[model samples]
Target: MPRKRACDSCHEKKISCDGGSPRCDWCNHRNLDCTYHRASASSRKRPQPAEFSLQDEIEQRLERLESLLQGLRRTDRGDPSPPAEISDKLPSKSQPPSHGGIFYGSLYFAGCHLGDISSRNGIPIFSDEGRRWVQDRTGEAAALEGGQELSDIDLDFAQNKLSDLALLGGHNSAPPLPTKATAQRCLDIFRASTLQVVFPVVDLSTFQEIIDRAYEETTESTRAMVCVLSFVSFLSLLEPQKTAELLPDVEMYATKAQQLLLLTMAEPTIEGLQAALLLCLYLDFSGQLQAASMLHSLASRSLFMLGGHLKPKPPSGATPDDARLRHLRTLFWLCYFCDKHISLRTGQPHAIADDQCDLALCDDYTGLDFIDLKMDGPSLAQYLPKPLQPSDLGLTIIKSKVFSLLFTPSALKKSDTEILHTVRMLDEELERWRMSVPPSVRPSLSSVSDPADPSLQHEFGMLLIFVRFEYLYLLSAIHRACGRCQAWSVDGGVPNAVRSSLLLSVEASRSTLIYLKVASEMVHRESFWLVIFYPLWASVTLFCNIIYKPSARHAQSDVELVSAVPSLLKKLRARVPTPSEALHLQRLEAFIAELIHLANKAIYKHRPENPTAQDKE
Candidate 1:
């Protein structure tokens, strides 16, 4: 009377069955035998209470067996045997303790079971013998049972040597602070540089006072302040005017800054936050992206801890000119900007979630007016652009919105229609932001010749170049979603909307390369590090497009554009001060060269004139 249940094969596989007479859909598709065993009414009525108990017993036995197998495997591979005292306490292989787990701000063992692997407050509690065994394996002494806190564990054990090298700059001792006059000159140079225009993190007056105190009372100088000074000097040396004589000092300052980072990190303060962020930037500029990323996470957490993400509440009597409040707000926005940009560039989740922070832009973010101290032959202001009003911070806010609307995990899962709607909305927002920029620096969708006015170009040229690159980068990122959604339909007929997006993405990549070539002529050596990610991202986009549609009308041109990336990198490499600094560029150039070769090969294979051997046969 009732419909037959799923076939035995489907039931065993835990899949739905069509319950066909001869065979179920799954069984028929797989060409496997299908059978149904009808139960008698008496058999169905009988309860099977022991079934769950039997399953639990089997799982427990399997876990023990798996643990034994892991131990045996380790033994065969010549790893030391577990100590006698805790031999029976070893966890199942599937649930082995993680050595690098962080709980709250302290190190702890993760995935350790209570009875099998005893733990207190998420930190494993090991017997003395077990601790010794862990120490021997991990190369760091383990926490004592019950007596030691997670903080007592050596966190350095979790990090690899590469991280150590990045943090310490391969040096053992701190270098002496540069002479007071030299430090002052470097600081002056920093204020006039494009680095200040782009970042605006440091407060000059406050930092100057710190410098004076460091020199006056040398013993009392904070590690954080020293770290900041070293970084400032390091970045200043990277400016275009730097000579070969100063190259050694550049490396020395960077090394000194990095070596002090650990000491600075031990105590969290606003100065410490600033020092950490400067070090993060240094790491990024030096092409240690992974190290920079790791430091960024720590710096971001530090920002949150210091309440830098929130709008500062001045103590009841505090005035509008309160330097501390202004500094806090400035640092907060800087962190926000760095978080969004890094996430976009690295394809990692942003440390600052838009929903969690007050996204209001402050007027004080522009800080003090740039002063041209004529320490060198000519003031840097005579050559570099005056800082733009509204600054790059406005663009950063737009980037935040872009990441939230287009790139978030939930946003990626949207339907084609939803994605199209979001893309249009974002395009409108981006266009409005671009329009707000001063006409001289406003980025255009199409590639154009250099600005006609040399003065305006000199004043705002770098701004215009970077804005254009970012505009195209964002355009590609937004349209790439539509391109991906339509990629699956390439064999079928692609919708008109998706086809347009794919074309737009390719065009954006083309425009990026064109603009980069133009910008290379005007941009300084110091800014070369900034352009590395752009060309790589753009070239890869073009490479993918050519491969996807090798027979398209523009495919030939796209291949040529992809081919040009390596040369562009070579030209940009010359701008960097040292070979070590250009390592990322070298790697990127080689990778793009390979991509070009593959793309050319793909085009040749797909040409209508070319026939496969099978076609000839």
Candidate 2:
């Protein structure tokens, strides 16, 4: 009798099947529905021995490759090999063994998490519980020393201000535009302020033309343009004394711009993209960082959809004087600038990747020749501030490189040696970039001792101050990797590499605070956002340093600097009109206060006379 054929299912699955009636033995064993097709004479031809051997070889090779891959995976996970005796045993049905590793649920960038430094190295005094214990002891010590109790203001503010600001959920209606005179006043203020210089997203003449046209006719494009203008006006009023009486109007304009931008979000245009970028700036300034970050992403995506990331090529036969294309390029660079800075500030990935676009500056920025237009008696250059230069974009490009090389996900995964090498290379590159800046606007590591040059102060002071703060901030960020990679000696001796990195990081933090302190007035007047993150970041670094080594020579001064944070934050809070600004400031003030208290307690315990006092407590 001819051999019975296998069922189709078993044959397709490449498994042995007994030719049973209605159902094969393999299908019956598995309780599967089985059907068999009638075998044709040609299909019944058996494979030659050589073919069978080849098929067996292929299967064996695949199995070996799979086993090798599994072994590699296990090695990557640091899993030890099982004993040969139990190698073929099935995994137990019982609960799997615990890996004994702690998993972190939240995102952490270099130097962002205090726990990373404190928890590692077994420093109990720097831990959260240790800080709480110190707080209790400090309260008792304060009571014994007749120290005044914390004021009711601080206590009440801490209790009430703990809630996060509501960044979303607002009225959807667009607020009415400001009166013509008020609008013009805002436009003038925006032009005069350093905001235009810093962002440089809009062309002054074009912006004026759009505003004039909006008053004449209300089209969709004009409406979006109005939104952009509203945001500029709102930012101009951030200086407390300049628009104290119109503080309420500041919110109105901000709301109007925000609502208008939302309306235009569904149909993104270049104008709408501009509005979104401006709104992002406003949100960041108001301490709505997450909202700002989301808006930034939206703007960045819109920019890509509009092909703003690529070099702008005018249409066929179009004149070389493509002002629109130039504007788009300007907007692209502004987005790039904001993307890098926001990523650093929030410890998040940047929206714009450097490799995706051209880094070269536009012809308008590189070309020095500008035909002076006579605006009545004043030239156009005198009438409106100059746009950003190649130097400005060059610094931004360097900043992009810093984020790419130092803080990126891949960078974070680099080995200790690789991280150290990359940090050194970036430091040298950053130093080179700094040296190339003109002396008039060059930033230094030391605090500014003399007043800025009156000639360049108005136009370039904000840029200079930002560069200084950013330099220190980047320095701290770069060297902080060393802290993560440093291995503690069994003998408790500090390694030279660790010492150098610690000093550099701490010095950068100190310089940031001192620079801000000296330039506080200018920073507050020109850009409130500049003061927001740098001071807090620096204060945290100082706090960590003091906690890590309370007996260090600068411990006392670090405490003093941390103590001064509340005052500085208060001054910043006074400049912004948002109620949430006060709440945000209060929370930071509380944190700084706690840090100062803990730092002071740690220092007291470390004193020679009080060496045994900590033990007694």
Candidate 3:
């Protein structure tokens, strides 16, 4: 008798089967899907590769059948089947983000989680007593307004996520807290190197006291303090060769610090905020982008919850320590600076809103020496302020406002008119900032030999370059946004609106490249990490134009602009200590090269002109 057809599943399993309609007996008995229907189809399509034997085809067919059966079995067992078209689309959740993706993802992750905390059972409470007092007063007001009061458990859980974690403690392999000597060493290193340069989140004297108190008696907060300093030590002090010796387990240290902070989260203090900031910066520099961003967001929320965002006026007839006030205020702005900086670059939403904050800009930081508090403190603006203020922190605050207004993700959702109006307002503010720069710190007035010339000098010039880099970056970002908004036309070809903005973007890009080229001469790894994304953004803009609109007004200029960026990146990369920087530059160079080749083909196809020879003639 002719062999009865069996399902693919039965055939692959080498089991006898009663070929039921649509399915076989063995598949049905096992509650598995039946592929016996495929047998007749497989027989009709007996075409095999000329090089493959019949056995090879049969083996391949069996293997494929087995795979299909396995998938069907999994589906029967409740596991979702993989997408049929997964080969065409990117595999989701199976691969890590690309390096560029990681960078931008880090920014997004940081922005989103800045204030994330569990609110179950009101377990986590605010760290600041002031916030608790405010909460009580608000609760009383609500009660007076006839609202029901929250239960104590609800209130405690509502406090913060840390309190929730503390209550729901689980064992984690966190590193041991440093001993007194170790903690003190880290504190001293942070105070000497990172404090003044990064922004002193807590006063040195106060942190010293915290450290001393830790030596006397250790607490969770003290342990967190030690961890924070340990991270800062890794960032600013520890020799690269000794990283293994010093930070044997960086992630463990970070986790321990986070846990300790959460455990004592109800009692928010300056030291806690300081520790959080250091840890965030360390995570950032260490390439733990997402973690850093999340931690930053958490610390920022804690600061806001603690009333750190609100500047408290000293009581009447009482002289408060303005130094302490200044330190706290500086910390708030530093947080704002970091949040806004990342948001602007990566097109993420900032953690805090503009209307939520009204604190003054960090005191004019110009001429502030490393050792003395004469020019760095809040009292300086009170006592020896300049008429045309030229301070790094002041510029950062101004840029933060611009970024909030224009560069955020929500900015794209606004109407064209609204975006243009905001851009104009930002442009006006930038111009105002330029005019406000004191001649001492201004790039124009200072002679080449002058000690203050940012271009010619090194020490002070580095800060000056930082300020300029930010200004140029924002300027380019604003115009670039305008270009994007105008780029699209109803006909799908390049429009007049886009063309003008594109040209403006190119000009701004050239100017930015020049600034980088100049800055690359004097500035090294220290400040490069802060503003590395600036040139990358500008280069990307130029590159996009070269590819999409190569036949537009400035094709030659665009090619030159794209070509120059890699050299500038190479210069910057030469001085950077991180291998990632070099890798990033190599990738950027490859991207630029690939795009330039495509752009050349596009230009040749569209215009069909020998413009190079014509220009040379």
lDDT digits (tens) for residues 1-617 of candidate 1: 33335565544332346678687776676556677664533466733212112113223423433443344344334223333322222233223333433211111111111111111121122334334323322234533332123332223422543364466544334445667776666677777665665565666657776677656645446564455455554465456364343344555566566566667666667677777777777766655555577777888888888777888664566564466766776777777766776766655677888788887765444311232122223345444332332137667777777777766656644444455566666666776677766554456655344544342245434555666677888877766656434222122233444545556666777888877666666654455555666776677667656544555667788787777767666665544444334433444455566667666765675565655201100
Give the candidates in order of lDDT, highest first.
Answer: 2, 1, 3
Best-fitting candidate, scored by lDDT = 2
Task: Residues 173-226, candidate 2: write the lDDT tens digits.
Answer: 234566656656666766765456556666666776556655564454555454
Task: Order the candidates by TM-score, highest first.
Answer: 2, 1, 3
Every model's TM-score? 0.65, 0.67, 0.59
What C-alpha RMSD separates each model from the true structure?
Answer: 18.8, 21.1, 22.3
Candidate 1 achieves a global lDDT of 0.55
Error of 1 at 206 (Å): 1.5
The model with the greatest TM-score is 2
Candidate 2 overall lDDT versus native: 0.56
- Model 2 residue runs over 4 Å out of place are 1-113, 116-175, 216-222, 225-229, 238-248, 313-321, 363-386, 389-391, 447-459, 489-494, 613-617
Name the weakest run of 10 consecutive residues (lDDT summed) in model 1.
103-112
Q: If both were scored by TM-score, which would come out higher, candidate 1 or candidate 2?
A: 2
